[model samples]
Target: MHSSKRKHIVVPLVLYCPLATFANTNPVAADDRLETVLVIGEQIKAALQAEQALTPGNVTVIDSADLYQRNIANLGDMLRYVPGIWTASGSTGDSTFFSSRGSNLDATNYDGNGIKLLQDGLPVTAADGNNHNRIMDPLGARYATIAQGANALTYGASTLGGAIDFTTPTARDTEPQIFLNDGSHGQLQGRVTTGLVAGAFDGLITIESKEWDGFRDHHQQERKGVYANAGWQFDDVVKTRFYFTYLDNDQELPGALTAEQFDENPYQAQPAAVIGHYQYNVETWRAANKTIFDINENSSLSVGFSYEDQTLYHPIVYSPFFSLLINTEQKNAGTSLRYNLHVNDHDLLAGINYGETTVDGGNYSHEAGRRKNMTTHVKNNADSLEIFLVDRWQIAPRWKLIYGVQAVSAGREVKNITVADGTLYNPGADYDSINPRAGVIYQFKSNNEAFANVSRLYEAPTNYELEDDSSPDNKALDAMHGSVIEIGARGKRPLGTHNKLHWEFSIYYAQLQDEILSIDNPTAPGTSLSTNVDDTIHAGIESLLGASFSLDANNNHRIEPLLSVTINEFSFDDDSHYGNNELPAAPGYALKGEILYRNSNGFFAGPTFDIIDERYADFSNTYTVDSYILLGLRTGFTHADWEVFGEVRNLTDKEYVSLFSVRDRAAPNAAILQAGEPRSVYVGMRLQF
Candidate 1:
């Protein structure tokens, strides 16, 4: 007989209930009248949790409640606690340069590649796997989910870094709220949000504004955004939701500093940035719709569509004589169809995902950020199609077999409208790949489980990586292919009657062929080129451990300690040019942890620390970035309808390099290092009605 405990509800749809916010205000009467709705909402959450548990790889779910308690200025600040991830702020604070599983470690620009970003399970990253412009603001998300590596097969993501999905908050879980934040370096931010629920319709709207004069000279940034969504429930089995978003982001780029300048003053921008008036600005508009249909008790279908339009204005130093100004108009559209079914002892998921992006770009010669002449104009387009299927079959009482496959086709096309230099070359390509995955999950106890999997990954180069090369040895770029093997375990155990301990640990190894890598040209100091590497290996361990202990018999006071660690070993596998040499960029190890004391009356204080080891800065391993330690503290008070928090970071004011541009060979005077922020403090408060 099939085990009843193993029977799980599968729903690919995300719906918001109408009475959740109301119940928060009038608890007694609302609870009496809308008890069933609340239960159904909880059931939806449980179903999502079940889906995550069924996966044979590492997955992390972060709630907005936990995020709001900290200073969330950017994506790097928001996801700092997650394991197997590395992130640093780029030229501007709003842009995050991130890497996962040793992917995209050589990127020097603000637009990063190698990972998939999604909103409500739909693609937000361009079809070419490029994270262009500014990443979405995390302030409006209700929760976020991260599927590491090939574990994201269900989402049609076969990239090395896997996928991240952010779910927006609806009227169901939101109320009228206001927040204000202020910190060092003239930083200020504010947000206002409200929600409505009537009959079968519900909606939520939020507006946010933020600005900061950063720690370094010439580093200034501003942002304004609006997030709104409306849902209509036609019946218990049918629901449709519409979303709209608008964002305006503007920032001044502080060019990287040389070793001499950094030692003299890490808070000064390079002279080139001031001379060229470097800046990156963008405006964006997005809209999306999702509809769900419950065909039967054990089957459901979900359809989604999304569109985005963006305009970018960027200017930067190209040479001592002049600057380069880049202007681009970009558009993206995507659609998804997913179906979930349960039969006998198997749960199946099938989906199709399609997306396309077009960019009309122009390069202009400029002086002091003023456009003078158009040098180059081009139009680039990328489209992708993915078909995937996943199955979880119960083979024994305590064991389950998980298997999946994905078929992908992608095309990158470039049209040279005008080439001022008289060189006409078509550097476009089409790629196709079929990847398969298999795993086993064994549940040894009700609260403990272990899993192992082997999967394949493939990624097509982005348009940026396919740029025209004028070298004699240049050849057509090929797609990246790799095979990954992973093993992991997660569980919760009672530490004592009034406390609990929870832990998650995983290890992964990948053998890659034709992996895309970029390095600054040895002949040209400012320009970079991309090429495929013959052989490489990426291996890493990710772990998180946490526990809470009550300080009193009444459990009115508690102490909690949480730790996260990531160890990386990325190296070349006996290549022609670089034989068994370690890769540059990511550090060998990272450790972060916090110890907190909490009281039942909603007060908490914590001390946190982060330690990052040394890493190389050049492919030849000639230069090294020294390891550094950072200290911080957080104190906060929370209540049902209000909260206040304070934070201090880099207490010792240690000067160190946070990030750097990759190079084939680095000079001692090269201007490639980006300085880390110095000592700073921040405070914020929130109110809800």
Candidate 2:
């Protein structure tokens, strides 16, 4: 069952219609396309241009241009150049897992523990507080910003490690663009975007579709989506906009590999696994309305409301011998409101959000060509509120001081109903917490900045973690919390008359409480379950450096080089079970570097390299994965009304594990490992008018 309340209001368009036409709405000019084009290396610049002042923090922007240049097809591929972020490739697809400053990657089971993912400023994680399998739809994204530690206080909820915001294209200009790509493994993708502008009124529409045969056996995925945006500006004082998106996806589940299978062949897919019979399908609809009011020339206020509905289903095989069958369904809805205010040198922001999720399913076992069934249901609800303030004070003509604080309150409730032994067991629990953040930054010159801050964030145990009533009653195990401290600096310098260099570096430390840990409890003294442990700490350093140089007499021909790296140290503080051990899926170091050459004719070419140090599969550090490196190349050309590009990923054909096996004891039981994809290539063309 689903329930919600709403109040509808209609505004007369007669008064605003004529004004909309005279509002100087140049659709393409007002849009963020150009901003997206420079996002990858100029994220800080874009933020500054948007009036988002940064203190001594590490922030990175990944623009559409970077994505195109690198042929990034998924989150893993896109984040390879971002320091402090680690990605794992599984048979199913790509997953991102990371530790910032010294937080355990598994503290909350790697489902976006220390980081938050926002789609157009709305949370995309499910009610369970996990975003592991969620596809971000890179094809639909215009720009993304990653802010680390306390620097992310501007956004509410989960800011211990960082916050990531992915903004879609808005109606600002009038243009039409199309893109197509074909790659190995039967992979293909297509996208189209069009815009219209009439005075102060503008609109944009986009559609994208993709299909892939996958690198592993029995693995296939298909996805498609449409998005639309409309906007109206009432002079320089006020503006309003609407956005909507619809998506559908279907994929095959390939399951995890066994340890033996891993030792024999890390790239082999399990053909006879029960998981091979499973398929997952999902559908989502989202809409938002936003308003910007200019309180005056120096201050503005922003408010918005967003709603999203998502449905998912998975058909699974229950047993290997008997060939049992089961299917599960999940539905979710969420709403949020936010406001922004700027006055003098101070900025203030606040927001509130709420969401509801429900799961229903039935289990069936195949016996003598007959089906035996069981039914179940689960529900969860979440609510949150956040408030923050930031100030940029000019202490002197050449120095600036920045500071801010944020407070957040969050709560969740979960309910589960399962039929067993002719009786239905109904159990539920609720968890809640308050988090706080504060940070400061100092600017020494136009090209230099430094800062430090401390923040507290928490993760409510997922529905699955606490839904079982058989577990011992332990309040301390209900939630995970982390406290982080960080300091860093960034600056740019002219290396020559026609060359400029920029660099950013940061170091952080974190202390965690009631960290969740998964255990093998097959023969435990009580019911087999995953539970929480207490006291852990993680720390690390993250850095980025780059330079741009003119290659010819005309500044139009240039070369840009970039490098990024992250190193982490993770350990359990109170228990000996995992003392002084690296967290699972936590890579100790990663390096990414690239060089790009561009000419005046709108042509560009680049080569890239990605390297990762060894990592452990578990907290015990008993099993280790060796380091690996990958090479890639891409080139693009733009003519009067057309643009074309091609890219090759993993050109060296390196084999590595992007994701670890969560089902260590499951059937078809290869070693609980999932292999990485092989070498692949993609080519595409686009037209605009």
Q: Evaluate all candidate structures by whole-model CA lDDT and list the values in order.
A: 0.83, 0.62
Compared with the true structure, model 1 gives a TM-score of: 0.94
lDDT of 2 by residue, 1-689 (tens): 01111110002222323333333334435335434333432554465334433554677766664465445567776776677776666655433444444333542343455566777666666555556346677656777777775566666655456677787665442245666667787677766676766678878777676677778766677777788889999998889888888888776666556667766776665554434355556677878777878877666666666666666555434344434334445555555555555655555555655555555554444442234554444445555455555565655665455555555545555543455544433334455555655566666777677777777767665554554323554332457777888888878889768889988888888888876655333332111255666777767888999998997766889998889988877777857565555566666788888888878798988987878787766556666666788898878886655677887778888877766632213334324467776788888776554
- Give the top-scoring candidate (lDDT): 1
**Tens-digit lDDT track for model 1 on 523-629?**
64555778889999999998989999999999999999999899999999999998888889899999988999999999999999999999988878888989999
Model 2 misplacement above 4 A: 1-52, 93-104, 107-113, 263-265, 272-276, 316-318, 321-335, 358-372, 390-403, 422-434, 468-470, 473-476, 519-529, 555-557, 638-641, 662-670
**TM-score computed on alpha carbons, candidate 2:** 0.84
- Candidate 1 wrongly placed segments (more than 4 Å): 1-45, 468-475, 522-526
Each candidate structure's TM-score, on Cα atoms with residue i matched to residue i, is 0.94, 0.84
Q: After superposition, how far is residue 370 of candidate 1 from its true place, in Å?
A: 2.3
